[model samples]
Target: MATRAVWRYRAIFAMLCAAIVFFALLPFGAGEGGVPGPDLIVCLMAAWILRRPDYVPVWLLLIVLILADVLLMRPLGLWTLILILMSEYLRRRVDHTEALPFWSEAGLVAACITAAYLVDHLALVLLLAETPPVLGQGLHALATIVFYPATAVFSQVIGVRRLAPGELDSLGTRA
Candidate 1:
Protein backbone atom coordinates (compact mmCIF):
# COMPACT_ATOMS: atom_id res chain seq x y z
CA MET A 1 0.00 0.00 0.00
CA ALA A 2 2.79 2.38 0.83
CA THR A 3 4.52 1.57 -2.43
CA ARG A 4 1.34 2.26 -4.36
CA ALA A 5 0.97 5.60 -2.63
CA VAL A 6 4.50 6.53 -3.55
CA TRP A 7 3.86 5.65 -7.15
CA ARG A 8 0.74 7.76 -7.15
CA TYR A 9 2.73 10.70 -5.85
CA ARG A 10 5.35 10.22 -8.55
CA ALA A 11 2.73 10.00 -11.28
CA ILE A 12 1.06 13.22 -10.22
CA PHE A 13 4.36 15.04 -10.04
CA ALA A 14 5.24 13.82 -13.53
CA MET A 15 1.93 15.04 -14.89
CA LEU A 16 2.43 18.48 -13.38
CA CYS A 17 5.95 18.68 -14.76
CA ALA A 18 4.69 17.77 -18.18
CA ALA A 19 2.06 20.46 -17.94
CA ILE A 20 4.72 23.05 -17.14
CA VAL A 21 6.76 21.96 -20.11
CA PHE A 22 3.73 22.10 -22.38
CA PHE A 23 2.99 25.60 -21.19
CA ALA A 24 6.52 26.62 -21.92
CA LEU A 25 6.25 25.38 -25.49
CA LEU A 26 3.07 27.30 -26.18
CA PRO A 27 3.45 30.32 -28.42
CA PHE A 28 2.52 32.88 -25.81
CA GLY A 29 4.44 35.74 -27.42
CA ALA A 30 6.78 35.97 -24.46
CA GLY A 31 8.88 38.68 -26.09
CA GLU A 32 8.71 42.45 -26.01
CA GLY A 33 5.19 43.91 -26.32
CA GLY A 34 3.91 40.35 -26.16
CA VAL A 35 1.87 38.76 -23.45
CA PRO A 36 3.88 38.25 -20.34
CA GLY A 37 2.95 34.63 -19.94
CA PRO A 38 0.95 33.93 -16.83
CA ASP A 39 2.86 32.41 -13.97
CA LEU A 40 0.21 29.73 -13.64
CA ILE A 41 2.84 26.99 -13.60
CA VAL A 42 4.60 28.48 -10.60
CA CYS A 43 1.29 29.02 -8.89
CA LEU A 44 0.46 25.37 -9.40
CA MET A 45 3.85 24.33 -8.14
CA ALA A 46 3.49 26.52 -5.08
CA ALA A 47 0.07 25.06 -4.37
CA TRP A 48 1.44 21.53 -4.43
CA ILE A 49 4.39 22.48 -2.30
CA LEU A 50 2.13 24.00 0.31
CA ARG A 51 -0.45 21.20 0.24
CA ARG A 52 1.82 18.17 -0.11
CA PRO A 53 5.50 18.87 0.17
CA ASP A 54 6.48 15.24 -0.04
CA TYR A 55 4.54 14.82 -3.25
CA VAL A 56 6.50 17.60 -4.88
CA PRO A 57 10.10 16.69 -4.17
CA VAL A 58 12.92 19.20 -4.50
CA TRP A 59 14.66 17.30 -7.28
CA LEU A 60 11.49 17.13 -9.30
CA LEU A 61 10.91 20.83 -8.77
CA LEU A 62 14.41 21.53 -9.94
CA ILE A 63 13.87 19.52 -13.10
CA VAL A 64 10.63 21.30 -13.89
CA LEU A 65 12.14 24.74 -13.34
CA ILE A 66 15.19 23.88 -15.43
CA LEU A 67 12.99 22.72 -18.25
CA ALA A 68 10.98 25.92 -17.90
CA ASP A 69 14.16 27.99 -18.13
CA VAL A 70 15.33 26.23 -21.26
CA LEU A 71 11.98 26.30 -22.99
CA LEU A 72 11.08 29.83 -21.97
CA MET A 73 14.49 31.17 -23.04
CA ARG A 74 15.23 32.77 -19.68
CA PRO A 75 18.62 32.78 -18.05
CA LEU A 76 19.25 29.20 -17.04
CA GLY A 77 18.72 28.42 -13.33
CA LEU A 78 17.93 31.96 -12.21
CA TRP A 79 14.20 31.48 -11.83
CA THR A 80 14.75 27.82 -10.99
CA LEU A 81 16.81 28.56 -7.90
CA ILE A 82 14.58 31.44 -6.89
CA LEU A 83 11.43 29.34 -7.14
CA ILE A 84 12.91 26.36 -5.35
CA LEU A 85 13.92 28.58 -2.48
CA MET A 86 10.50 30.18 -2.37
CA SER A 87 8.70 26.82 -2.43
CA GLU A 88 10.89 25.40 0.28
CA TYR A 89 10.21 28.42 2.43
CA LEU A 90 6.51 27.97 1.90
CA ARG A 91 6.79 24.28 2.74
CA ARG A 92 8.38 25.07 6.06
CA ARG A 93 5.77 27.69 6.81
CA VAL A 94 3.06 25.17 6.01
CA ASP A 95 4.18 23.04 8.91
CA HIS A 96 3.55 25.87 11.34
CA THR A 97 0.61 27.72 9.83
CA GLU A 98 -1.44 25.06 8.15
CA ALA A 99 -4.48 26.24 10.05
CA LEU A 100 -4.09 29.85 9.03
CA PRO A 101 -6.90 31.58 7.18
CA PHE A 102 -6.91 31.78 3.39
CA TRP A 103 -6.21 35.50 3.46
CA SER A 104 -3.02 34.84 5.42
CA GLU A 105 -1.95 32.27 2.90
CA ALA A 106 -2.61 34.69 0.09
CA GLY A 107 -0.56 37.30 1.87
CA LEU A 108 2.35 34.91 2.14
CA VAL A 109 2.09 34.00 -1.52
CA ALA A 110 2.10 37.66 -2.43
CA ALA A 111 5.24 38.23 -0.41
CA CYS A 112 6.96 35.25 -1.99
CA ILE A 113 6.10 36.41 -5.47
CA THR A 114 7.42 39.84 -4.72
CA ALA A 115 10.65 38.46 -3.33
CA ALA A 116 11.09 36.22 -6.34
CA TYR A 117 10.74 39.12 -8.76
CA LEU A 118 13.12 41.27 -6.76
CA VAL A 119 15.74 38.55 -6.68
CA ASP A 120 15.31 37.90 -10.37
CA HIS A 121 15.70 41.56 -11.14
CA LEU A 122 18.80 41.76 -8.96
CA ALA A 123 20.33 38.82 -10.75
CA LEU A 124 19.74 40.45 -14.10
CA VAL A 125 21.38 43.63 -12.90
CA LEU A 126 24.39 41.79 -11.48
CA LEU A 127 24.85 39.93 -14.73
CA LEU A 128 24.60 43.21 -16.66
CA ALA A 129 21.63 41.92 -18.61
CA GLU A 130 18.87 44.24 -19.67
CA THR A 131 16.09 44.12 -17.15
CA PRO A 132 12.49 44.81 -18.05
CA PRO A 133 10.75 47.87 -16.70
CA VAL A 134 9.79 47.81 -13.04
CA LEU A 135 6.12 48.15 -13.93
CA GLY A 136 6.24 44.99 -16.01
CA GLN A 137 7.85 43.00 -13.23
CA GLY A 138 5.31 44.28 -10.72
CA LEU A 139 2.42 43.31 -12.98
CA HIS A 140 3.83 39.85 -13.50
CA ALA A 141 4.20 39.31 -9.79
CA LEU A 142 0.71 40.66 -9.19
CA ALA A 143 -0.73 38.24 -11.71
CA THR A 144 1.07 35.35 -10.06
CA ILE A 145 -0.19 36.34 -6.62
CA VAL A 146 -3.71 36.80 -7.92
CA PHE A 147 -3.75 33.38 -9.58
CA TYR A 148 -2.45 31.41 -6.60
CA PRO A 149 -5.81 30.93 -4.89
CA ALA A 150 -7.37 29.59 -8.05
CA THR A 151 -4.45 27.27 -8.57
CA ALA A 152 -4.76 25.94 -5.05
CA VAL A 153 -8.45 25.30 -5.61
CA PHE A 154 -7.69 23.54 -8.86
CA SER A 155 -5.11 21.35 -7.15
CA GLN A 156 -7.55 20.35 -4.43
CA VAL A 157 -10.20 19.57 -7.02
CA ILE A 158 -7.71 17.42 -8.89
CA GLY A 159 -7.12 15.25 -5.79
CA VAL A 160 -3.83 16.64 -4.57
CA ARG A 161 -5.34 16.97 -1.14
CA ARG A 162 -3.08 17.11 1.88
CA LEU A 163 -2.19 13.84 3.51
CA ALA A 164 -3.71 13.19 6.89
CA PRO A 165 -1.41 13.11 9.93
CA GLY A 166 -1.36 9.33 9.96
CA GLU A 167 -0.71 9.17 6.27
CA LEU A 168 2.05 11.77 6.49
CA ASP A 169 3.76 9.73 9.21
CA SER A 170 3.55 6.56 7.20
CA LEU A 171 4.81 8.21 4.05
CA GLY A 172 7.60 9.90 5.92
CA THR A 173 8.84 6.66 7.34
CA ARG A 174 8.65 4.88 4.01
CA ALA A 175 10.28 7.67 2.11
Candidate 2:
Protein backbone atom coordinates (compact mmCIF):
# COMPACT_ATOMS: atom_id res chain seq x y z
CA MET A 1 0.00 0.00 0.00
CA ALA A 2 2.74 2.42 1.02
CA THR A 3 4.89 1.66 -2.01
CA ARG A 4 2.00 2.06 -4.41
CA ALA A 5 0.98 5.40 -3.00
CA VAL A 6 4.56 6.58 -3.08
CA TRP A 7 5.03 5.56 -6.68
CA ARG A 8 1.74 7.10 -7.71
CA TYR A 9 2.60 10.49 -6.30
CA ARG A 10 6.15 10.25 -7.54
CA ALA A 11 4.89 9.59 -11.02
CA ILE A 12 2.64 12.62 -10.82
CA PHE A 13 5.50 14.78 -9.68
CA ALA A 14 7.64 13.50 -12.54
CA MET A 15 4.90 14.31 -15.00
CA LEU A 16 4.54 17.82 -13.62
CA CYS A 17 8.27 18.33 -13.90
CA ALA A 18 8.23 16.92 -17.41
CA ALA A 19 5.38 19.23 -18.30
CA ILE A 20 7.40 22.16 -17.03
CA VAL A 21 10.32 21.19 -19.23
CA PHE A 22 8.04 20.65 -22.20
CA PHE A 23 6.37 24.01 -21.77
CA ALA A 24 9.73 25.63 -21.36
CA LEU A 25 10.79 24.24 -24.70
CA LEU A 26 7.59 25.14 -26.51
CA PRO A 27 7.65 28.35 -28.49
CA PHE A 28 4.85 30.20 -26.75
CA GLY A 29 5.35 33.73 -27.96
CA ALA A 30 3.68 36.86 -26.66
CA GLY A 31 2.09 39.39 -29.07
CA GLU A 32 4.61 40.68 -31.62
CA GLY A 33 7.09 40.34 -28.77
CA GLY A 34 8.56 37.00 -27.70
CA VAL A 35 6.06 34.79 -25.93
CA PRO A 36 6.66 34.26 -22.25
CA GLY A 37 7.36 30.57 -21.77
CA PRO A 38 5.83 28.89 -18.79
CA ASP A 39 8.25 28.86 -15.89
CA LEU A 40 7.09 25.58 -14.46
CA ILE A 41 9.68 25.05 -11.78
CA VAL A 42 9.26 28.48 -10.27
CA CYS A 43 5.50 28.23 -10.06
CA LEU A 44 5.51 24.59 -8.99
CA MET A 45 8.26 25.07 -6.46
CA ALA A 46 6.53 27.95 -4.74
CA ALA A 47 3.32 26.01 -4.24
CA TRP A 48 5.07 22.73 -3.53
CA ILE A 49 7.23 24.26 -0.87
CA LEU A 50 4.23 25.73 0.88
CA ARG A 51 1.84 22.81 0.50
CA ARG A 52 3.26 19.60 -1.05
CA PRO A 53 6.81 19.20 0.16
CA ASP A 54 6.34 15.48 0.69
CA TYR A 55 5.83 14.87 -3.01
CA VAL A 56 8.60 17.10 -4.38
CA PRO A 57 12.01 16.32 -2.99
CA VAL A 58 15.32 18.11 -3.29
CA TRP A 59 16.65 15.49 -5.69
CA LEU A 60 13.72 15.91 -8.03
CA LEU A 61 13.94 19.68 -7.77
CA LEU A 62 17.61 19.52 -8.68
CA ILE A 63 16.87 17.19 -11.56
CA VAL A 64 14.12 19.42 -12.94
CA LEU A 65 16.26 22.50 -12.61
CA ILE A 66 19.15 20.82 -14.39
CA LEU A 67 16.83 19.69 -17.13
CA ALA A 68 15.56 23.25 -17.50
CA ASP A 69 19.12 24.50 -17.74
CA VAL A 70 19.95 21.96 -20.40
CA LEU A 71 16.79 22.70 -22.32
CA LEU A 72 17.42 26.45 -22.17
CA MET A 73 21.19 26.04 -22.70
CA ARG A 74 21.80 28.06 -19.57
CA PRO A 75 24.92 27.84 -17.47
CA LEU A 76 24.96 24.22 -16.34
CA GLY A 77 23.98 23.63 -12.69
CA LEU A 78 23.14 27.31 -12.15
CA TRP A 79 19.37 26.90 -12.24
CA THR A 80 19.67 23.76 -10.13
CA LEU A 81 21.49 25.60 -7.40
CA ILE A 82 19.11 28.57 -7.52
CA LEU A 83 15.93 26.51 -7.43
CA ILE A 84 17.22 24.20 -4.69
CA LEU A 85 18.40 27.10 -2.63
CA MET A 86 15.06 28.86 -3.04
CA SER A 87 13.13 25.70 -2.20
CA GLU A 88 15.15 24.99 0.92
CA TYR A 89 15.01 28.58 2.00
CA LEU A 90 11.26 28.72 1.50
CA ARG A 91 10.86 25.35 3.23
CA ARG A 92 12.51 26.60 6.39
CA ARG A 93 10.55 29.85 6.32
CA VAL A 94 7.28 28.01 5.89
CA ASP A 95 7.86 26.25 9.20
CA HIS A 96 7.72 29.70 10.75
CA THR A 97 4.72 30.66 8.64
CA GLU A 98 6.69 33.42 7.07
CA ALA A 99 4.99 33.23 3.71
CA LEU A 100 1.39 33.61 4.79
CA PRO A 101 -0.02 35.03 1.57
CA PHE A 102 0.23 34.33 -2.17
CA TRP A 103 1.85 37.62 -3.00
CA SER A 104 4.49 37.08 -0.35
CA GLU A 105 5.50 33.83 -1.96
CA ALA A 106 5.47 35.48 -5.35
CA GLY A 107 7.67 38.29 -4.11
CA LEU A 108 10.18 35.91 -2.61
CA VAL A 109 10.39 33.71 -5.67
CA ALA A 110 10.71 36.69 -7.99
CA ALA A 111 13.50 38.27 -5.98
CA CYS A 112 15.48 35.07 -5.82
CA ILE A 113 15.02 34.31 -9.49
CA THR A 114 15.93 37.83 -10.51
CA ALA A 115 19.08 37.71 -8.46
CA ALA A 116 20.00 34.36 -9.93
CA TYR A 117 19.44 35.67 -13.45
CA LEU A 118 21.58 38.71 -12.85
CA VAL A 119 24.35 36.69 -11.33
CA ASP A 120 24.24 34.06 -14.02
CA HIS A 121 24.13 36.60 -16.83
CA LEU A 122 26.91 38.66 -15.33
CA ALA A 123 29.11 35.62 -15.01
CA LEU A 124 28.41 34.66 -18.58
CA VAL A 125 29.18 38.17 -19.74
CA LEU A 126 32.50 38.23 -17.95
CA LEU A 127 33.58 34.65 -18.47
CA LEU A 128 32.03 33.51 -21.74
CA ALA A 129 33.05 34.62 -25.21
CA GLU A 130 29.58 35.04 -26.67
CA THR A 131 27.90 38.35 -25.88
CA PRO A 132 24.19 38.09 -25.08
CA PRO A 133 21.82 40.56 -26.74
CA VAL A 134 21.19 43.27 -24.20
CA LEU A 135 17.69 44.22 -25.38
CA GLY A 136 16.41 40.67 -25.45
CA GLN A 137 17.88 40.00 -22.05
CA GLY A 138 16.18 43.05 -20.60
CA LEU A 139 12.86 42.04 -22.11
CA HIS A 140 13.17 38.53 -20.71
CA ALA A 141 13.71 39.93 -17.23
CA LEU A 142 10.72 42.21 -17.62
CA ALA A 143 8.53 39.35 -18.77
CA THR A 144 9.67 37.12 -15.94
CA ILE A 145 8.92 39.79 -13.37
CA VAL A 146 5.51 40.50 -14.85
CA PHE A 147 4.59 36.85 -15.09
CA TYR A 148 5.94 35.53 -11.78
CA PRO A 149 2.86 36.24 -9.68
CA ALA A 150 0.59 34.55 -12.19
CA THR A 151 2.74 31.45 -11.87
CA ALA A 152 2.39 31.64 -8.11
CA VAL A 153 -1.35 31.88 -8.49
CA PHE A 154 -1.37 28.79 -10.69
CA SER A 155 0.87 27.04 -8.18
CA GLN A 156 -1.68 27.72 -5.47
CA VAL A 157 -4.37 26.23 -7.63
CA ILE A 158 -2.55 23.12 -8.83
CA GLY A 159 0.10 22.20 -6.28
CA VAL A 160 -1.70 22.55 -2.95
CA ARG A 161 -2.37 18.96 -1.91
CA ARG A 162 -2.64 17.77 1.67
CA LEU A 163 -0.41 14.99 2.98
CA ALA A 164 -1.53 12.67 5.73
CA PRO A 165 0.47 12.83 8.94
CA GLY A 166 3.42 10.43 9.07
CA GLU A 167 2.80 9.81 5.39
CA LEU A 168 5.46 12.46 5.07
CA ASP A 169 7.72 10.97 7.71
CA SER A 170 10.22 9.77 5.18
CA LEU A 171 10.18 13.10 3.44
CA GLY A 172 10.74 14.96 6.69
CA THR A 173 13.55 12.63 7.59
CA ARG A 174 15.21 13.21 4.25
CA ALA A 175 14.80 16.94 4.60
Candidate 3:
Protein backbone atom coordinates (compact mmCIF):
# COMPACT_ATOMS: atom_id res chain seq x y z
CA MET A 1 0.00 0.00 0.00
CA ALA A 2 2.80 2.42 0.83
CA THR A 3 4.65 1.66 -2.37
CA ARG A 4 1.46 2.18 -4.26
CA ALA A 5 1.08 5.64 -2.74
CA VAL A 6 4.62 6.49 -3.70
CA TRP A 7 4.10 5.49 -7.31
CA ARG A 8 0.76 7.22 -7.46
CA TYR A 9 2.19 10.52 -6.22
CA ARG A 10 5.12 10.17 -8.58
CA ALA A 11 2.70 9.83 -11.45
CA ILE A 12 0.83 12.89 -10.27
CA PHE A 13 4.02 14.91 -10.14
CA ALA A 14 4.94 13.78 -13.64
CA MET A 15 1.58 14.77 -15.09
CA LEU A 16 1.62 18.20 -13.44
CA CYS A 17 5.06 18.85 -14.88
CA ALA A 18 3.80 17.82 -18.31
CA ALA A 19 0.94 20.29 -18.06
CA ILE A 20 3.32 23.09 -17.10
CA VAL A 21 5.53 22.31 -20.07
CA PHE A 22 2.59 22.12 -22.42
CA PHE A 23 1.36 25.54 -21.39
CA ALA A 24 4.85 26.92 -21.81
CA LEU A 25 4.98 25.79 -25.42
CA LEU A 26 1.71 27.42 -26.46
CA PRO A 27 3.45 30.35 -28.25
CA PHE A 28 0.62 32.75 -27.70
CA GLY A 29 3.13 35.57 -27.17
CA ALA A 30 6.47 33.89 -27.48
CA GLY A 31 9.34 36.39 -27.08
CA GLU A 32 7.08 39.42 -27.21
CA GLY A 33 7.80 42.41 -24.92
CA GLY A 34 6.48 41.00 -21.69
CA VAL A 35 7.90 39.54 -18.52
CA PRO A 36 9.12 36.00 -18.73
CA GLY A 37 7.12 33.72 -16.48
CA PRO A 38 8.46 31.96 -13.41
CA ASP A 39 10.05 28.58 -13.88
CA LEU A 40 7.14 26.59 -12.56
CA ILE A 41 9.05 23.42 -13.25
CA VAL A 42 11.66 24.34 -10.67
CA CYS A 43 9.02 25.46 -8.22
CA LEU A 44 7.18 22.19 -8.47
CA MET A 45 10.30 20.11 -8.34
CA ALA A 46 11.69 21.87 -5.33
CA ALA A 47 8.38 21.85 -3.51
CA TRP A 48 7.73 18.18 -4.06
CA ILE A 49 11.28 17.10 -3.47
CA LEU A 50 11.62 19.00 -0.24
CA ARG A 51 8.29 17.83 1.05
CA ARG A 52 8.52 14.23 -0.08
CA PRO A 53 11.94 13.39 -1.42
CA ASP A 54 11.06 9.91 -2.57
CA TYR A 55 8.36 11.14 -4.90
CA VAL A 56 10.60 13.24 -7.18
CA PRO A 57 13.50 10.95 -7.80
CA VAL A 58 16.26 11.98 -10.18
CA TRP A 59 15.32 9.52 -12.90
CA LEU A 60 11.84 10.99 -13.21
CA LEU A 61 13.24 14.50 -13.17
CA LEU A 62 15.87 13.63 -15.74
CA ILE A 63 13.31 12.35 -18.20
CA VAL A 64 10.81 15.16 -17.67
CA LEU A 65 13.41 17.92 -17.80
CA ILE A 66 14.94 16.47 -20.92
CA LEU A 67 11.54 16.41 -22.56
CA ALA A 68 10.93 20.01 -21.54
CA ASP A 69 14.26 21.07 -22.96
CA VAL A 70 13.51 19.45 -26.27
CA LEU A 71 10.02 20.88 -26.44
CA LEU A 72 10.99 24.38 -25.27
CA MET A 73 13.98 24.75 -27.62
CA ARG A 74 16.49 25.45 -24.87
CA PRO A 75 20.16 24.65 -25.33
CA LEU A 76 20.29 20.91 -24.86
CA GLY A 77 21.40 19.70 -21.44
CA LEU A 78 22.41 23.05 -19.99
CA TRP A 79 19.32 23.73 -17.91
CA THR A 80 18.66 20.06 -17.43
CA LEU A 81 22.10 19.39 -16.05
CA ILE A 82 21.96 22.28 -13.61
CA LEU A 83 18.46 21.52 -12.38
CA ILE A 84 19.29 17.89 -11.79
CA LEU A 85 22.21 18.92 -9.68
CA MET A 86 20.07 21.39 -7.76
CA SER A 87 17.46 18.75 -7.16
CA GLU A 88 20.07 16.43 -5.73
CA TYR A 89 21.38 19.17 -3.54
CA LEU A 90 17.92 19.77 -2.16
CA ARG A 91 17.20 16.09 -1.82
CA ARG A 92 20.38 15.46 0.09
CA ARG A 93 19.49 18.07 2.64
CA VAL A 94 15.92 17.02 3.40
CA ASP A 95 16.81 15.38 6.68
CA HIS A 96 18.65 18.41 7.90
CA THR A 97 16.02 20.87 6.68
CA GLU A 98 12.71 19.24 7.45
CA ALA A 99 11.92 21.59 10.30
CA LEU A 100 13.00 24.86 8.77
CA PRO A 101 10.39 27.59 8.59
CA PHE A 102 8.79 28.53 5.32
CA TRP A 103 11.03 31.52 4.67
CA SER A 104 14.11 29.40 5.13
CA GLU A 105 12.82 26.84 2.71
CA ALA A 106 12.07 29.68 0.36
CA GLY A 107 15.56 30.99 0.93
CA LEU A 108 17.08 27.62 0.12
CA VAL A 109 14.97 27.42 -2.99
CA ALA A 110 16.02 30.93 -3.95
CA ALA A 111 19.64 30.14 -3.24
CA CYS A 112 19.61 26.98 -5.28
CA ILE A 113 17.92 28.81 -8.12
CA THR A 114 20.34 31.70 -7.85
CA ALA A 115 23.26 29.32 -8.02
CA ALA A 116 21.75 27.51 -10.98
CA TYR A 117 21.17 30.78 -12.84
CA LEU A 118 24.70 32.02 -12.24
CA VAL A 119 26.21 28.73 -13.29
CA ASP A 120 23.98 28.60 -16.35
CA HIS A 121 24.95 32.15 -17.35
CA LEU A 122 28.64 31.50 -16.83
CA ALA A 123 28.48 28.30 -18.83
CA LEU A 124 26.64 29.81 -21.78
CA VAL A 125 29.13 32.65 -21.89
CA LEU A 126 32.02 30.22 -21.89
CA LEU A 127 30.41 28.22 -24.67
CA LEU A 128 29.89 31.34 -26.76
CA ALA A 129 26.18 30.58 -26.86
CA GLU A 130 23.55 33.27 -26.89
CA THR A 131 22.34 33.84 -23.38
CA PRO A 132 19.14 35.48 -22.26
CA PRO A 133 19.49 39.00 -20.91
CA VAL A 134 20.63 39.21 -17.29
CA LEU A 135 17.73 41.38 -16.23
CA GLY A 136 15.25 39.02 -17.74
CA GLN A 137 16.82 35.95 -16.22
CA GLY A 138 17.04 37.66 -12.86
CA LEU A 139 13.38 38.53 -13.03
CA HIS A 140 12.58 35.02 -14.04
CA ALA A 141 14.44 33.64 -11.04
CA LEU A 142 12.73 36.11 -8.75
CA ALA A 143 9.36 35.17 -10.13
CA THR A 144 10.17 31.53 -9.56
CA ILE A 145 11.11 32.24 -5.97
CA VAL A 146 7.98 34.30 -5.50
CA PHE A 147 5.79 31.50 -6.74
CA TYR A 148 7.35 28.70 -4.68
CA PRO A 149 5.08 29.08 -1.68
CA ALA A 150 2.04 28.62 -3.85
CA THR A 151 3.61 25.59 -5.41
CA ALA A 152 4.30 24.11 -1.99
CA VAL A 153 0.73 24.75 -0.98
CA PHE A 154 -0.45 23.12 -4.14
CA SER A 155 1.65 20.04 -3.46
CA GLN A 156 0.18 19.84 0.03
CA VAL A 157 -3.33 20.22 -1.31
CA ILE A 158 -2.77 17.39 -3.75
CA GLY A 159 -1.60 15.07 -0.90
CA VAL A 160 2.11 15.19 -1.64
CA ARG A 161 3.48 15.78 1.82
CA ARG A 162 6.28 14.91 4.19
CA LEU A 163 6.52 11.25 4.91
CA ALA A 164 4.80 10.35 8.10
CA PRO A 165 6.95 8.79 10.83
CA GLY A 166 5.43 5.40 10.13
CA GLU A 167 5.91 5.77 6.41
CA LEU A 168 9.54 6.73 6.88
CA ASP A 169 10.20 3.66 9.02
CA SER A 170 8.32 1.50 6.55
CA LEU A 171 10.83 2.51 3.92
CA GLY A 172 13.49 0.88 6.15
CA THR A 173 15.78 3.89 5.90
CA ARG A 174 15.86 7.62 5.67
CA ALA A 175 14.99 9.26 2.37
Candidate of highest TM-score: 3
Residue 43 in candidate 3, Cα distance off native in Å: 0.4
Best by lDDT: 3
lDDT of 1 by residue, 1-175 (tens): 3366656866777787687678667766566755465588688887877777777778888887798788878899989999999988988887655777878877888888899999999999999998988878888888788888988898899877766655552255311
Runs in model 3 deviating more than 4 A are: 166-171
Task: Output the TM-score of candidate 3.
Answer: 0.94
Query: Which of the two, 1 or 2, has more TM-score?
Result: 1
Candidate 1 — which residues are off by over 4 angstroms? 28-35, 165-170, 173-175
Q: Is candidate 1 or candidate 2 better by lDDT?
A: 1
Give all candidates' CA lDDT scores.
Answer: 0.78, 0.64, 0.88
Order of candidates by TM-score, top first? Answer: 3, 1, 2
Q: Which stretches of candidate 2 lie over 4 Å from their true place?
A: 1-7, 27-38, 129-131, 159-175
Q: lDDT per residue, candidate 3, 62-164, as tens digits?
A: 9999999999999999999999999999988888777788899889999999999999999999999999999888988888989999999998999877766
How many backbone clashes can be found in candidate 3?
A: 0
Candidate number with the higher lDDT (2 or 3): 3
